[model samples]
Target: MPTPNQAALDFLLNRRSRPAKTLTTPVPNRAELETILTAAARTPDHGKLEPWRFIVLEKPALNRLAALVDQRGNDLGIDPDKITKANAQFATADLVVAVISAPVDSPKVPQIEQVYSAGAVCLALVNAGLAAGWGANWLSGWASHDRAFVTEGLGLAEHEHVAGFIHLGTEKNAPPERPRPDLAAITTWVDA
Candidate 1:
């Protein structure tokens, strides 16, 4: 017989991500954020290749990013509505952790595996923030995928990419539970 951790299971089952727009000020401070980040860094990293890094973006940095989003959107001739939404993502954010997927060169570990690790880190970060009593949401927009924007704004290397931008703050509103996938429909029992 195995002892089950009910608290952990309960949290996992009931956890909900607050929308980025619904997040507000009073985010975690440096020391508090360090604890949350430490939890996030404990994710699985096969081959010991830490294929991810975190960049904490404060209000000033976010403002800069918001401006850059506008510039990049204009330069790329993106839809005006898209630019406004993307700009608001950064402009209104008080705190965000930019998960950078920096895949290491390893013959044993495939690049795809490294990318997956980075994505896992993003999820871990969001979960960590939520566990720490902060509203958290994982976000990625057109600016995150734009090479020029990442290069100029975030100073990402050629091999690095934006895994996700985790917004963290106080929750303004509690969103109603949305529909969840049916596990039975997606499950496959392969007994070969």
Candidate 2:
């Protein structure tokens, strides 16, 4: 039988991501964020490729990103509402961890697997922050998908991509629980 830690199990069972828009000040400090990042880095990486990294964006960086988002929105002729929502991510963020999916060349590990690992890191970071009593939300708007934004705003390499932008801060208010997926409807038990 596998031994289980009750606290950890309980946390996972009830885990919920706080709304990024509702997050306030008193964000995690450098040391604290480093600890969270370390925990997040413990995700499964096929072939030990470690095909992911993080970029911490604080006040000034967030402001710059907000401006860049606006610029890109205008250039792309995006809807004003969509542009506003994307800009809000940076303008309201107390702190954000940009999970960069930096795939590495390897014979054993597939590129798709490396991308999956990067996604896992993003979820792990969000979970770690929530576990540490911080309000956290994983976000990726149209700006994140824009090549100009990725290169100029984040200085990402050609092979790198944004996995997520994890916004972290104090919870302004408790978010109500939303509808959950029906396991029976989605799950398939196969015996082959």
Candidate 3:
């Protein structure tokens, strides 16, 4: 039988993401955020490609991005409500770590795997923050996929894109636990 850490399992089972909107000030300091990022760096990487990087955003950067989002939305003729919603994330975030999916050129490791690794890093960062007693949430909106926004706003290269924005801060209020997916309905048993 495989050994299991009960505490870790319990934490995995009960861990819930706090809404970014509910996050407040008194965010993690540089040293603390670095510790969390270090923990996140342990995500699985195929071919050792290390196909991701983190961009820490403070108030100024976040505000600039929010303005960029508004401009891009207007340029693209996007819905006002949607643009407002997306802008709010950057406008209100106490701190954000933008995970960039920068896939490395690897003969053995496929591009999809590299992208998945980047996504893993995002989740790891969020979980690490929550474990460290901070409120964290992973968010990506339409602007993430917009070429103009990704290129000009975040300065992502052609081969790179935003996997997610990990928002971290103190929780202003406890969020109610939402209903979970039906595991039995989603699970499939493969038997010979």
Candidate 4:
């Protein structure tokens, strides 16, 4: 016999990310968000490298980042439409947690494993937000991958990279149920 957390399993079965643009004001406060971050920090890490960190982007920081994205897009000769979309991604959000993949050098752990740990943190954060009754979406775009944008806007280290920007806020509208992957199509059974 196995003990199972039914509530957690139910939440996982129904969890869906709300659209970033659809999230409104009334985001989690510092203490509340700290709780969510604490939950996110519980993600499994190979070698315990702890390769992930969070940057909470409040409204003012988001606004500044939005402007920086515009400038960087122009400097890089990116399409104007892309610039606008990315700018809106930041400008429209009330709160975001930037999951920074800060991989540390470890002989026991490969760099790719550290990177995967960071990615796991991102998903954990999104799930934490959702479980806490806040709408959350994990996002990343051109600005996140642009060196100048991350270095100047977020002050990331040379080795650190953005795993994702987990946007969190009040849900304006419940998103419709989207199609999920077919288990049979993607699953494999092995027996010996």
Candidate 5:
């Protein structure tokens, strides 16, 4: 019989990401954040490509990113409303970990596998924050897709992209549980 880890299972079943906008101050300190990053690095990496990295944005960096977003939005002729909302994300953020998808060139490891590894890193960071009793949310908006934004805001190279921006902070209020996927509809079992 397989041993059941009830506590871990319970935590997974009940885990819900807090809204980034609702997160407040008391963000994780450097030492605490290092622990979280260590946990995040434990994600699956096929062929050991390690195709992901993190950029932790503190107060000053977040402010600079917000300014860059505003400038990029103007340069791209985006709607003012959209720019406002996008800038707010960084302006109000207590701490954000930018998951950079740095896919390595490898004949054995396909690029798609590298992208999947980066995605796994994103989820690991989210789960690590939640397990550490912090409010966490993975978010990416229009700015994430803009080349100018990626380059100037995040300094991404041609081969790198932003997988996600994980916001972590204390929750002002616990968000109620949202709907969950139906297991029967989403899952399948096969015996061949």
Candidate 6:
């Protein structure tokens, strides 16, 4: 059997995401955040295309994003309830890293793999924060999918899209564990 890291395996088994609302101030500082980002960047890239990037949002920028979300939601005729929910997240955000999926031109590396890499980066960022004793959650809502919001609020390019918005902060309270999936039901075994 290959040598295993018990602590790492234990963390993986018990890892739970803290809800965004429960996340408070005291996010990762510059050097510390850089460590997390570095961990996140260690995702798989088939062709070294590195088809992803991170945009860290502070309080002021988050406030501006909230306003932009409000405006865009109204302009796009989204329901008031949905608009309110979307705007609220930005308004209350302490700090977030916007995971952007920017697929590059690659003859062998497929676009789908690039997208998956971006997603892995998001998950890695979340786990890094959690392991460092901070609350972290990955969230993406209607705002992420809105082209106008992505361009105007976040300044993302035409080829870029938000894979996830990873919010990191101090934990307000330890949340109870929710229901988990039944592994047997979701698993498939085949020996061909």
**Candidate No. with top lDDT:** 1
lDDT of 1 at 93: 99
TM-score of each: 0.99, 0.98, 0.97, 0.98, 0.97, 0.98
The lDDT of each candidate is 0.96, 0.95, 0.95, 0.96, 0.94, 0.94
Encode model 5's per-residue lDDT on 1-192: one tens digit a residue: 999999989999999999999998999999999999999999988888789999999989999999998999999999999999999999999899999999998999999998998888899999999999999999999999998888987889988999999999999999998999999999989998
RMSD of each: 0.6, 0.8, 0.9, 0.7, 1.0, 0.7
Off by over 4 Å in 6: none
Alpha-carbon deviation at 10 in model 2, angstroms: 1.3
Q: Report the C-alpha lDDT of model 2 over 158-186, residue by residue, as the tens digit.
A: 99999999999999999999998899999
Model 5 accuracy (lDDT, Cα): 0.94
Question: Model 2, residue 51: displacement in angstroms?
Answer: 0.5
Question: How many clashes in each candidate?
Answer: 0, 0, 0, 0, 0, 0
Worst 10 residues of 5 by lDDT: 147-156
User: After superposing candidate 2, which stretches have Cα over 4 Å from the reference?
Assistant: none
Position 157, candidate 4: lDDT = 97
In candidate 4, stretches whose alpha carbon ends up further than 4 angstroms from where it belongs are none
Q: How accurate is candidate 2 locally (lDDT)?
A: 0.95
**Candidate 1 global TM-score:** 0.99
Residue-by-residue lDDT tens digits, candidate 3, 1-192: 999999888888999999999998999999999999999999999988889999999999999999999999999999999999999999999799999999988889999999999999999999999999999999999999999998988889999999999999999998999999999999999998
Report lDDT (Cα) of residue 78, candidate 6: 94
